[model samples]
Target: MGVIKHQSIRSTLLIYIGFAIGAVNIVFLFPRFFSDTQFALTRLLPEIAIILVPICTLSTVPAISRFFPYYASHLKDKENDMLTLALGATIIGFSLFVLGTLFFKDAIIKANIEKSPLFITYFYLLYPNVFLFSVFGVFESYSGSRHLTVFPNFLKELVLRLLTTVLIVLHYLSWINFDTFLWLFSLLYGVLLLALLVYLRRHKFLYFNFRISRVTRRLLPKMATYSLSLLGASLFTLLANNLAPLILTSSKGLQDVAYLTIAQYMSQLIMVPQRSISAIGLPVLAQAWKDKDKDKIEEVYVKSSLLQLTYALFVFLIIWSNIDSFFQLLPPNYSVGKYVVLCLGISKVIDMGTGLNSQVLSTSRLWRYDLYSSVVLLALSLPLNYYLINHFGLIGTGYATLLSMLVFNTIRYIFIWVKFGLQPFTMSSVKAIGVALVAYFGCIWIPLAIHPFVDIVIRGILFLAIFVTLVLAFRVSGDITSTIYSAVNKIRRRQ
Candidate 1:
């Protein structure tokens, strides 16, 4: 429990730093500098790479999970075998994807992608990005397995974002054209790959033994099988998540897609902590499940839910309360999709509230359920996104996403509850929600009495005070109270 608490705190701080950097990129700079079509490209390109990377990398995650325990024990000998298997799978996946893209070139080009012809060029750029991202996944997975979450967090959340900011600045200064910008974007992945290589070399973990013994050959098939299955699930999930943006761009145009992207970015900010928690939790959960530690698994589930809800609620309140001001910061044209922010924010809050059930399931024996659920989501998402976007534009897309997430999480919650009696919502969960509502409403009135910036600052402080007071007064959780005391002591010590 103490280990989980410590890891969660460290990971949370790292994620917040990442979130701050991401906020600047998404909220302030991208919208301010890029045109609608450019913004859409910026968002969509990454979605394309994210979708492709996991598929190409295949079972890198499960392989990491399987090997991490061994790798931790035998760092010198096993690192090369793991890296060989991971890189080999990545190459094979990339080759197959590239070949498929070549054969289906016309179909892909005619997908009504944003910027049409221009977007097709970006597909080539995705190759390098995909390769680098896939490789980095191995490094990240290795780091997670070793309980070194902060380094990967820094590389992924901070370094990558900082690079984007630098690139944006370079473009602003007339140092790079849009075409060069695309290339530079791909180059950033190369930088990450190099960085990971350097880190591995420094740690003496970058050797490769191409022995191809019977054991190694045998392990390859098993790893490939696992990767393929995980890849299928991942690909479907990506399709479900990105289908709306694709539909919106096809039906509405790039401008509407841009608006949807911004709103989606705003909403996704709420999930930063969730992502952080999932990253730190995945390896730990896998270990627990492997050890058959049911009590530890349940403990992780409950405490993660509580912590996630606490931070998620804080972020949601801050975003919702200052939404108007937030949208006001964007160009008036971009502000049209502001309602999408509210809808998507609600969806993410629901997701965060579910804790790490999906992660636990993904890493446990019931992992096949991810593939089934992803298929269900993909089936539902296409028509839902198509119908909604055709009728409602950007907000319709949000509705489609909200409905999909609601369905997905509800099913997951039911499955976990029925299978393990592992429900995340307790009486305290209900009380926390109630307190959040009170803080949310209470902050609303503060805005009426002051300027937007001042109102935001004041209300933010007030919301924190009220929320803490309510939680403490209500005696929400022994763990949370102790956490607050520890944090306070740390602050006092620093002072």
Candidate 2:
């Protein structure tokens, strides 16, 4: 528990650091400097890459987890064999993508490029970025299985974002054109891939031992099988997340896509804590499942849910409270998509409130349940997105997302409750919600007596202070209180 808490804190800090850089890039730099077309290109490149990541990685995450314990045990010759297998899988996956692209080149070009003349030339940039990002995902998952997450976190949350920021600045200075920016993105991904390879080599985890025993050979098929199942869920999840942007770009113009992108970026801030918790939770959940530790699983379920909701609600309030200020920071034109923020915010809130239920389902033997649910959600998301985006434009997409999240989270919660009797919320959860509401309203009402910014600052401080005080007063979980005290003591000691 101590280790998990420590890792969670460290990961959260790193992720927030990354988020800060991302905020600058998305909120300030990109929107401020880039034209609507450029911004759309920026957003579209990533969506394409994310969609391609699962296809190119071939669901290497489950394989990495399944194999890492073995590689760790047989650290000498077997490490090389694992590396060899990973490299082989990556190459095969990439080759498949290339072959598919070649076969479907006309359709791909026509669908993505024909409509958006600005993105036509840069559409090819998506390939390398997607390929490298997918490869990085494989390595990150492997590092995660080894309980080595910080470096990957740095690469993901800090390094990549920092690179993007630097590139954006260069563009601002008129040093790099949009084409250069797109090319740089691909190159940056390649650099990260190289860095990962170097790290693996330095740690002696890059080589493949060809000492293929009968057992190891037999395990490959099983690994491949699990990887496929995991891939199905992963692919569907990525599609659901990115389909809105794809549809928006295709149906609407680049300007519309740019606005929705900003909204998506702001909404994503709400999920940072959930992302951090899920990162640590997945491997732990996997191990617990392997051990069949029902108590540990239940403990994880409850604690992770509470903690995630706590942080999520805090972020949600902050975003919602400062929604106007957030838009004020953007250009007047960019602010047109303000409602997209509310729509996406609601979706993320529902998602975070569910805790790490998806992680639990993904890592448990009940993974198939997740696959089924994900498929249903994906099916629902496409039509919903198409309908909403067509009728209501970007805000409609947000509404579609909210609808999808509602269905998905409700189903997951109900299933977890019925099968495992593992409800994430208790009376304390209700108390936390009450505290949040009180703080939110307090912040809103107090502002009536003051200016917006001043009211925001004062009410924000009061909200946080009062919220903490109430949590302490109610004594919701001695562990959480102790953790708070420990953190305070550490800060005091440092001072």
Candidate 3:
């Protein structure tokens, strides 16, 4: 709990900072500075790489979290082969990816050539993009194994995004051509990869124990089975998530992809707390499962659900409250994504409200169930996305996302509840929602200023005032209020 508390706050803060920079980059800079087609390429390429990186790492990210305890218990600090295993696995996975890419290269180009020529023209850059993300993911996972999540989170959340902001700004200033911008952006992951490596080495967290331990050899069979399940789980889940944009890019065109991309970015704001909590939860949940500590796992489950829902609702309501004002800052064509943000925001709220069920299932004895869940996700998402986008256009993509996520989260929720009797709700859960709604409705009617900025600030301040006061008064989240009290007590003690 202490680790979750300490790290989640910092990680969430840094995540928000990254999102702030990202908001500028995505919401403001990219739309105006880059054309629709160019912006679409930026969004799709990284998305494809994100899906590819997990495959290139053989899903070692989760494997590292779930198995690191075994390595730690059996070997000395520098003698554990976790780092060696992760790095080796990703490189091999990347090699296999290269082989597959050679065969599918023409097919990929042909698939996109009709509607998204920009993506095809820049197709060569995707490999480097994926390779960098692949290695960076490996190190990030290994570092997480050491319970060293903060630095990696910093590098990924803060450093990478800041660099991106700079790159976009550089482009905005016409310092580089679009081709060079695309190339530099792809290579940016390599820069972060280098930074993570240095951070690990300096912290003495870098170790190569290529010598396989008795524990690893014995656990190898179980791990192979676990990895295989998670491998499909990872790919299906990633592919399902990236499906909307990919489908939209190939079927509709890049301009529509650009709108979906911005809306997705906005929706990601609601998920900032989920990212922080999940990253912190991985190693924590893994260790608990390793010890067969149901009590610890449930404590994390309930508290995390409450805390995350609180933060998620706050962010969501704020975004929902000011979405129109925010979009007004963007180009006129971008405003059509209003419904995209709504549908995606509600889906993320439900997703976060369900807490760390996915992590629990993945790390627990019932780990293989994740494979079934992901298969369902892809099975549903593929057909739904294709059909809906072909029919409803951009908002149709949003509808598909909402439906797919609803089904996906519902399946995982049922799995956790039926199998383990753990659920992520409490009385405070309802109270939190009530508080968010009250605050949201409370602020919306206040007059709109002529300037979008003024409207945002006034409504934002009033919304925070109402939301925070009510949350504290009602004790909607004990974790959050307790944190505030603890900080205040420390301040009084110092005085």
Candidate 4:
């Protein structure tokens, strides 16, 4: 728990730095520098890469978390080289990805050309984008397995965005045209992969002990089954998260997809705390499962839920409370996305409330349940997104997401409870929700006349003060209250 807390705090702070850069890029720069179509293209390209990450990495990321403990114990035997196996598997998976893209290129273009014809010119960039990120994802998992999570977080959350800022600046300076900017933007992932490769090599974790002959027949089948199940689980999870944007690209148009992308970014900002914890927690959870320590796992699950609910609700209220002022800061062209922001913000809040349910199930013997649950959720999401987008447009996509996530998280929670006797709920979670609602409603009527920047700052500070005071007054979460006081005491001491 100490390690989880330490690494999570480091990663959370790093993630927030990344979010600040991304906010500047998405909220300010993209709207200012790129046309709606160009912005949509930028959003769609990385989205395609994200979609392909699990496929091209052959589920190696999750495989690392689930199997690295076993492999670590066998390192002395030099037996079953997990790194070599994962790398070999990734190469084969990437080759398959390329072949599939070649085969389906026409179908893919045709599907998207109607609403997002701008994508046709940059279609070839998709493979390299996926390749780079897939490799990066594999290494990130490997690093996490070694308990070196902070470096990858730095690369992903800080360095990548910093490089992206440089690229955007170059484009704005007219040093590069739009086409070159797109090319360089796609190449950012390639640079990221190299950076991680160098880091791993320097740490001496890049050993290529391909001792495949030493693997037992029993272990081979088990590894194969786990990898394949994780592959399904990862694919379905990506689909549930990303399919709506792709569907919007096809059904609504590039402009609408651009709108939804901004909303998604805003919503994902609230998820940083949970994601940071999960990145650091998965390895711990896997080790716990290996030791058969259900108590430790349950402790993590409950504490993670309480802490995530506290942080997520605070972020949600801040985003929603300042949404009008925030959007006003953007160009009028992006005004339609306020509803998109609101609905997706609620959806993310629901997701963050579930804490690490997916991680718990994925790292436990019940991992295969994730595949089944994700498949059902994906099935539900597709039709709902399609129908809703046709009837209600972009905001309907948010509605579909919210509904699917509510159902998906509910199923996972029930499975965890019934199967493992673990339920991540407490009176503290209830109190946090109560505090958020009160803070939100109480601040909405405070008044608004200043600049959007001033308005957001005033409203945000007021909301935080009110929410913090109430939570502390009610002792909603001791962990959160202690953290607040710790920061205050540190400030006092410095003064």
Q: List the residue pairs that clash in candidate 1.
A: 59-227
Candidate 2 — which residues are off by over 4 angstroms? 70-80, 202-204, 211-215, 446-459, 477-479
Count clashes in each candidate, considering only residues at least 3 apart in sequence or on different chains. 1, 5, 0, 0
Model 4 lDDT on a 0 to 1 scale: 0.86
Clashing pairs in 2: 80-207, 80-208, 80-209, 81-208, 81-209
Q: lDDT for every model?
A: 0.77, 0.78, 0.88, 0.86
TM-score of 2: 0.93
Candidate 4: where are CA atoms >4 Å away? 77-80, 213-218
Worst 10 residues of 3 by lDDT: 77-86
- Please give the ranking of all candidate structures by lDDT, highest first, separated by commas: 3, 4, 2, 1
lDDT per residue (tens digit) for residues 1-495 in model 2: 455666777888888889888988887788779788888888888788888777787877666765555555545544346655665777788889888978987886687574577877676787787778887888877777767677777778889999998998898899988778788877787887788778877886665555665445757787777678878888888898889878877778678888888888878877877766777777777777777898888888888777777777777787777777666667888777888888888888788877888878877766778878889789889999999899987788888888998998899999999988888887778877887787777676653333545655676787788778877888765556887899899999999
| Residue clash pairs of candidate 4 | none
Per-residue lDDT value at 406 in model 3: 96
Q: What TM-score, over all chains together, does every model reach? A: 0.93, 0.93, 0.97, 0.96
- Whose lDDT is greatest here? 3
**Cα displacement (Å) at residue 387, model 3:** 1.0
Model 3 residue 95 distance off true place after TM-score fit, in angstroms: 1.3
- Per-residue lDDT for 1-495 in model 1, tens only? 667677767767776787778778877887778777787787777777787877777757656765455444544554346767677877887888788889998888877654454567667877777777777887777767666676677777788889999998888788998888778877786787677778767876666766564445545676566667777777888888888777766666677777887788777778877777787787788788878898988988987887788777878888888888777667788778878888888888888988887777877777778777778888888888888888877788778888998998888888888887788888888888888999888878853544666656777888889899998898777777888888899999999
